[model samples]
Target: MTKIKTHLSLAVAISGLAATPAMAQDTWEGMDTNSVRGEVQQRYDAALAATQDPAYISANDPRYIWASEAKAQCGIALGYLKSRTRDEVSLSKCRMAYDRMMDVPRPRPVIAATPPPAPVCNRELPGLIFFEFDSATPGPDAAEIVSYVTENAGPCNWSSFQVVGHTDRSGSNAYNLELSQRRADAVANLMTSRGIPQSALDTTASGEESPRVPTADGVRELQNRRVEILVNN
Candidate 1:
């Protein structure tokens, strides 16, 4: 029966999860005057401490049954010690119970580090540059908007840019087409002057077509005569 109990105790301790004893009881340091009592007391304290380890605390399947067996063995060992009986078998069993619990691996905890926030660009994009009637210039007001885009371009991740020019329905279709190209060129030049890369600029003209305000032919609409800065970041 004792051999069967020992095998069962070992099986539970092995099946449950035993590890390098997490935190041993301090009583291991203080030994009793009698050799048998001191040994039993030491092994008892150690076996109990093994069950309290972090790895076994949450997963207590093996700890409870094995700890009960260890306690019973320790109790028998203690009884033999009190009677001054030289029962080497009981003492050996107590040692085996304690040693069985000292063998499993524990999983350590891991901590994660927090990452920093990314940079953000608050400037408005797809900048509009309106031209005066019959002229290609974007007017002085375009300077502030261009400056904003130029300075914030890097932060805003602006890679490619398109300067699309448009004309109001006033001149002949051929004349308006030529005028729109000139207007697009003028805005592209202005952007390049403001430090925008020339290689990144693309110009397109839509003359007297796709008007913003939708005006009839020969009408001069202020909204239609403009170039737009389209950012493709």
Candidate 2:
């Protein structure tokens, strides 16, 4: 009889993270752990189907085992983050598990099968809108960009729209953070008003930490002060 190996359990990986009891249970509170686990099980099955190798689409294939485990953990980690339980330790463990799984050698294909075309998802709009110093108002070009997003997002049935704001390094860190957040909010508000649902939008401020170009402390860079829009389906 052939000995079958099972993928490492997510609980075992979580235990290795050395999570504090409070941190681990924070998001699980007020929720039925059994029910959530069942939901995750369904997602795991779907992911396995999505990642299964065409040549060996069976439960015994080590490739399917590896892909499903990595995907399940990654999905769980994202769920925790989305639930407002963001922790570096949990995220690091998930990433490591995925990397280690992908590092393994996959079986050579005995039969050639043309893989299905990848799904069309995620779009980065052309031409970012540069912002004036300390201003949240959209200029003429910025308005055009915003219009494109508004017209396309709902029709595309996008799952989420990310508005990331950045700023030049001319101001204090505190000031830049606030300015960047305001700019992101301005863009998000415009999109929501134009028909995009508020629930589908996320706003983040990068401040001076993520400049388009490296510059001195007091330098004003035009490209750095901008908002990036990403649509993910």
Model 1 Cα lDDT, one tens digit per residue, 1-233: 45335445655553343223332232334444395587787777766565444444333244534553464456555655666654444455566556655544444543665343222232223466667678987755467557756765776688778888999999999999989999999988888999999998999998888786667789865657888788865
- CA lDDT, every model vs. true structure: 0.64, 0.59
Candidate 2 per-residue lDDT, tens place, 60-125, comes to 434544444445454544445445444444444444445455565655654666555332222534
All models, RMSD in angstroms = 35.8, 17.0
Lowest lDDT block of 10, candidate 1: 116-125
Compared with the true structure, model 1 gives a TM-score of 0.47
Q: List the residue pairs that clash in candidate 1.
A: 18-104, 19-104
Off by over 4 Å in 2: 1-122, 125-127
In angstroms, what RMSD does candidate 1 have relative to the true structure? 35.8
* Model 2: lDDT of residue 39: 42
